[model samples]
Target: MNQIRPLIPLLVTAGILIGGNGLQGTFISLRALQEGFSPSVIGLVGTGYNLGFAIGCVYITRVIRSIGHIRAFSALAAIASAASISMVLLIDPFFWFLMRLIQGICFAGLFATVESWLNARVTNATRARTLSVYRFVDLGSVTLAQYLIPTVGIDGFQLFAIISMALTLSLVPISFADRSSPEPPDAVRFNVKTLWQISPLATVGCIVVGLTNSVFRSLGPVYAQGIGMSIAAIATFMSVGIFAGVVLQYPLGHYSDKLDRRKIILVATLGSLAAGVFIAFVAGDSTLLNYAGIFFFGAFAMPLYSLCSAHANDHAKEGQHALVSAGTLFFWSIGAVIGPLFASFMLDIFGPHALFIYMAAVLALFLAYTVQRMTVREGVPAEKRTMSFRNLLRTSTFFNKLATPPSEDKPENK
Candidate 1:
């Protein structure tokens, strides 16, 4: 507790920043829908965020390195706050899409700055524990942020103002902190060919996850709204799914360490597929059925990225874990960019329920691929498994530093 005490301000900042971003995400979707934006345009707006995020992942480190963390964070926070309020000024889909793109880049830089600073504060002994606390912060903040939509009501400018305030307020704690800024994180590397060569299954798993999960995150509100759910119900629906993801991550990760990680990936993907099917065909307009289906859906689908990361690290050489982590995100971002656009088209053609059908189809294909990989190659020997399972957050490359297990050959600061 004493060791973590000094970092409390940063954690508070993280919570505020993450909460604001979370609210902004759901709000944008619902607002766009209310404005009578076509499903395709909504999807494009989501894609814009993902695309900008990927770009930031590749380049934001340089900004931190050049200007240092504190200034970079302040700038990013200001930009993010501006971007949040900018949406209310112009309700045009294209304008919102552009704002979302800017929001994405700013938030990406914000996360990279915060996470890398956290990494600097902890020693190897405290890394995992600190990460666990940070993950809890993330989970709690994002889940609670959903309720803000219902409380404020998404019709007017209040939600956007609240989001802007949250982002702006995040800067206060950090500005007053006693500690000096941490060193900048290493530049993100995307060694695609090498990552695929090391673990094709892990690569494919990330892409599959990106495709299916991004849809749910970006379009699930649309699904809920389309099904005649109220604003509060939509919040509950999204929150339940996210909460379920946090609940199931540890147990799934524990089992993956004992056996082949691919098996756990397969199990998670199958669960997501089943839940998707239940939501699409069985739930209909029954709120109870929808809630139950989303709970199961999130439980299985949310942990696949960590599972895949663990599997990939099992094959990675000593210092290659960072590269593997960055590469995994690269592929995932690729899928994320494409997923919403395609899913929106599906929603346009088939209606709200088709959202799950599209997700289920993707999961089914990934499930088959996982099975085939199992047949082709034997599981990693327990003695050879260099890394254990850690919940891989898609925040930044430096975030992966906490996720990497302490191996015999300590990785040098990349």
Candidate 2:
């Protein structure tokens, strides 16, 4: 506990970011639905933010390095706040895309800054626990945000304004925290192709993670509405599903830590595959079943990327954690850019149900490939696997700046 005292401000900052960010695109989706935008336009509206988010993650590190953490974060936060409010007023789809792009950049920059701070605060002693705590806070806040959106009533520009205010409020904790000074400026660097060489498994894992997770994040609510769930139900359904994942990540992480990380990835992919089939077939019109099945989905689906990330780190050369992390984010962005468009197009043609069809197929293929790999290569025995997430669960104080620096440029992780 003493070791993490300096991190309180960082944790609070995360709380605000997650809580606010957790709202994700609820306001946009809601308003678009209310305005009677076509399904495809709505998908684009949501996808636009993610597009920006990926771009922001890629470059925010450099922007921060050129200035400093506080200034960079402050700029991003202020801009995001303005953009959020502007979005509420500017209802045109094209303009929304522009706003979303800027908002994405700001959101990603804020996340990058926070992640870098978290990394700087850690040493070897408490790495896993810290990561667990930080991730829990993140996912927990996501669940809360999902729940909170229904209260905003989802019909007007008001919700967008609320998000704007929330983003502005986020600046307070970070700016006024009791911490004495910000860390020194950092120059960011990471190479995607290089990381791919170091760990192809991890690189592919990152892209797969991005593809599935962003699909749900961007389109789940829209999917719910298409399936005949109401607005409030959509909020609850989405939050519950996400909360299930939130609750399960620690156990899953612990379990993965004990085995060949690839095995854990394989299992998770299989679970997602099952969930996809269930949604496509068994989960017909029964909201309760949707909620329950979504819980299981979240359980297996949510943490796959983080698992891959940690796995990659385990095999990484010294000080490559951040570099690998950035590489992972790069692949993630690639997947994010592709997943929603493809899913949305399918929704446009085969129907909304096709969304899950695509998911099921993708995950199923991944599971097959992972299984084939394990069979061909020698792997650790199943019994030898053990992960300690159980002890690390529930009781969390928290804290990575996710930009990940490389050894050559920063001497951290290049």
Candidate 3:
């Protein structure tokens, strides 16, 4: 526990920042719906944020290096707080999209700062413990913060004000926590072709996840509201789906280690496909069925990124996990930018049920690709695999570094 003592302030900052960010996302979607924006327009807003997030992933490291970590973090937090409250200033869809874009950039920088600092602080011995603690804080904060929407009610200034205040308060903990800044994060070399050559299944799987999961986070609330759910029920619906992913991540990752990781990816893809079908066709207007379907959907779908990361790591050369991670995230961001726009268009045309249909279609294609790959190539031998499975969140490249155990072989000192 002593090793984790210094990280408390960082963890606390994560909880605060994530809680506010989580709440603001759902709140914005619900508010947009209430204001009579079409599903397609609302989806465009999601796309804008994701696009900005992708931009940040590519460039934030440079900013951190240039200005230093603490200053970068404080600036990002302040801008995010400003963006959160700015939503009320104008009710335009385009305006909201712009604000979300700024928020995405700010948040990407903020997470990069915190995660890189944490990565710099830990040794290999304490890596797993720190990861577990950080994961718990991230998941717990996001899950509980869903209720903030219903608590403040999304129709007024209270929720936005709360989001702003939360972002502002996040500044307090980290500002005082460490007097000296940690080293800047390593810049990600985003060579998509190289990552594709390393592991195509993992590459495609990350994209599929981005295509599907971003829709759920960005538009799930809109779907719930369309189906006549109460505001509180909407919160429960989103929370239930997110929290359920924890139940299956570890077990599936453990089994993947024992066998070909692609086989595990196939299982998860099938499960996600099945759940999407159930939600789209069978659930209909039944609240109970919707909740149950999403519960299973989240259980299967949320772990795909982590599984793909593990599978890619199994094949990555020494010193290349960071590159693999950055490449996969780049692909995932591409999907995130496109998914909501496409899904929302379908929602407008065919109604909210189209959301799951789109997801199921994407998963079905990914499943077929997985099967084809397994046939074409042999699996990595169990003895040759290097990295163990660790749960991952799509935060930053530095987070991936911390999750990966250091390679065992010593340097030759060239």
**Candidate 1 C-alpha error for residue 186, in Å:** 2.5
Candidate 3 overall Cα lDDT vs. reference?
Answer: 0.89
Instruction: Report clashes for each candidate as comma-separated counts.
Output: 0, 10, 0
Candidate 1 residue-wise lDDT, 58-168, digit = tens: 888889989999999999889988988988998888888898889888888898888888877877777767877888998999999999888889898999899889998
> Residue 249's C-alpha lDDT in candidate 1?
94
* lDDT leader: 3
lDDT of 2 by residue, 275-365 (tens): 8889878997789988887778878887787777666665566556557656777777778778877787788777767878888888887
Model 3 lDDT per residue over 29-93, tens place: 99999899999999999988899899999999999999999999999999999998998989999
Question: What TM-score, over all chains together, does every model reach?
Answer: 0.97, 0.87, 0.97
Question: After aligning candidate 1 to the native by TM-score, how far in Å is the CA of 27 from where it should be?
Answer: 0.9
CA lDDT, candidate 2, residue 302: 77
Instruction: Name model 1 segments beyond 4 Å from true.
Output: 405-409
Q: Candidate 2 has which clashing residue pairs, if any? A: 115-400, 115-401, 116-401, 254-387, 258-385, 258-386, 405-413, 406-413, 406-414, 407-414
